[model samples]
Target chain A: MTIRYPNGKKYVPVRTSKSQKLKNPSFSNRGKSLEDELNESNDYYLSRGIAVIHKKPVPVQVVKVSYPARSAARITEAYFGTPSTTDYNGVWKGIYVDFEAKETKIKTSFPLNNIKEHQIQHMQNVTNAGGFAFLIIKFTTLERYFIVPFEMVERKWDRMKAGGRKSITLLEFENTSVEVQPGYIPRLDYLNAVETLMKLYDDKIER
Target chain B: MTIRYPNGKKYVPVRTSKSQKLKNPSFSNRGKSLEDELNESNDYYLSRGIAVIHKKPVPVQVVKVSYPARSAARITEAYFGTPSTTDYNGVWKGIYVDFEAKETKIKTSFPLNNIKEHQIQHMQNVTNAGGFAFLIIKFTTLERYFIVPFEMVERKWDRMKAGGRKSITLLEFENTSVEVQPGYIPRLDYLNAVETLMKLYDDKIER
Candidate 1:
């Protein structure tokens, strides 16, 4: 039941070593999967009646299957299908919250290639629909996470297409994005940053 | 791959034949899949900048896979996983929209067994979050569709569990639920029915 990445790399669940944990107890979950942490945070929010966000399941096209005696049916042939939207979405304080999360080992910059074109378009649609859309990006090496609103990302995305840098520098990300500090129970509490964006939206409406 | 229902019945994509088409021009998509129609309607809304609804992909647990070519990889073994949430959700008119769609061939009543317990709980969660949640049910035999809000459905669900009727009669459904007349371009035109519910919500808020 091993799942590999599309690039043929073995999908390993990152775990902090005992020595590393001892060295930095605060960042014990430094190398762990951002997706897993986000799922945990979502569960925490759901339990506390905070939000109802969920990660969309991976799309696959099944071509063949088999049924063994006294066993469950198994798909024998399938291929990954392109997703039409972003990863996570739900209702937060009666607001539609839509977002995508990604982690990169590189410390200097976050590559735009990590994101797909359709996902960007989907975020734009969410924004146009008056939904809160953003990206939760994690720098694995730096053990930092930030929430970048769709508007900011769209500006940089458009810039990249017009003979600009292929990636967003760490300096630029730190300046434009809201830094989300990791926590024990929720793991990655990005909602706090969402509240800030909510205030900004409210203020805009007031003006 | 061939898919089968939990009851061991093969999953067949319903299609309207020439004879059926000739019989009912309005119900031209009589036997076609409801999921496909919903997808088309979602696409229509997306293109027109109306709403941003999407169907969540079916979750599958991959057990084994093989790389046949340098670029193409095939899943050799997998199994369908139970979904944690409903099939479709998005933002509509600054409101969180969540729903599950089902089609039944029975003419008299709609079976409660068509929906799982978790799905009911999920819909309740959506409602509690101040989001719009409902079911798009199609009675295939009569070619009739209805949007049953979670509150009404929840009452019936609780009643069934307390030794009440195991199914909702067509008479009850027609009276309680919002009837959605099918259209040409979007096909389902369920949003029009949604507007009725929206008005009811707005009136309640004013009071």
Candidate 2:
């Protein structure tokens, strides 16, 4: 089944090789999507009282509905609505956490087009409010994940707007972004990186 | 038109009498529902950079969808899902804000059944994380609104669990909760009450 996004983009499923699955038979997220893994991570965080993050429901505009005499109301027609904000947001240790997760198959660079303009604006808003905002960049093919801070994103976005490089290089990611290793309970374990980000902010304040 | 909630409860729209509308002709929200007013207030806050709050979309589980030949994909089958968390939450002035808005025609007491068990749990999680959590209770018939802190609600909930009163009386509300007066730019200015709540917390820490 194919699910179309608000922009009419078809949701593509990431395929895992049989050999790769067999090689990592013990892991739970062998063939799972980034979104699914992140959700599982959130569940782990919630169950342990570590965080209260949640993914917002996909925005859909219901155009028509029919109520059967003895049954529940059935939605007859609906269209996906463009998201005005990022997917995940919640509080962690008295600090606000907001971030967007995007999986890219490209290994050399992470494209700027993966995030929308308004989404960047929303992240900027969160950061301006003293909240921690970042991007969870999942290199699906490379089996790597990095938590790219919004400040870095904003700088690149500004440069891109001025006709500079259209994407951030892997070298840049290695140098600036905090890498998160995949694990068992919390599939992604991105909060460790978040803690690092928080410390960086604290150090800046102290300075 | 009626929209059923995930629990199969039909959404009842607040009806405004013609005389009442005439009496409050100058107000933009004369015939508006509490949800509408709250959304407008959030918009006002967002535009002014005061805060970034948003009402989560109604949760719907899409069972089936059809991709038309030329037009957009249409959801042919879906069911409303019970909300796992409160309707609204966001960041405000470096603080995390979480809340649920509820309206009642009954002026004597605010029914406890309006909030669910998991929702209370969600608010408790927010408070435990050192985030701000509250309820925007609108007494439609009495034209009164209150910002009821989670602490007050928690006390009442525990009392109810032990076979005490299931509802909070208007007298109790007036004594404990912060009253929010309706206005033009922002229909219900509950953030001012939230500021008061933050001050209360600061004072407690200082003490």
Clashing pairs in 2: none
Fnat of candidate 2, please? 0.67
For model 1, give the RMSD to the true fold. Answer: 8.3
Window of ten residues with lowest summed lDDT in model 1 chain B? B198-207
Off by over 4 Å in 1: A1-27, A201-207, B1-27, B201-207
RMSD for each model, in Å, please?
8.3, 8.9
TM-score of 2: 0.86
Clash pairs, candidate 1, are A63-B1
- DockQ scores for all the models shown? 0.52, 0.44
Q: What is the TM-score of chain B in candidate 1?
A: 0.83
> lDDT score, residue B177, model 2?
85
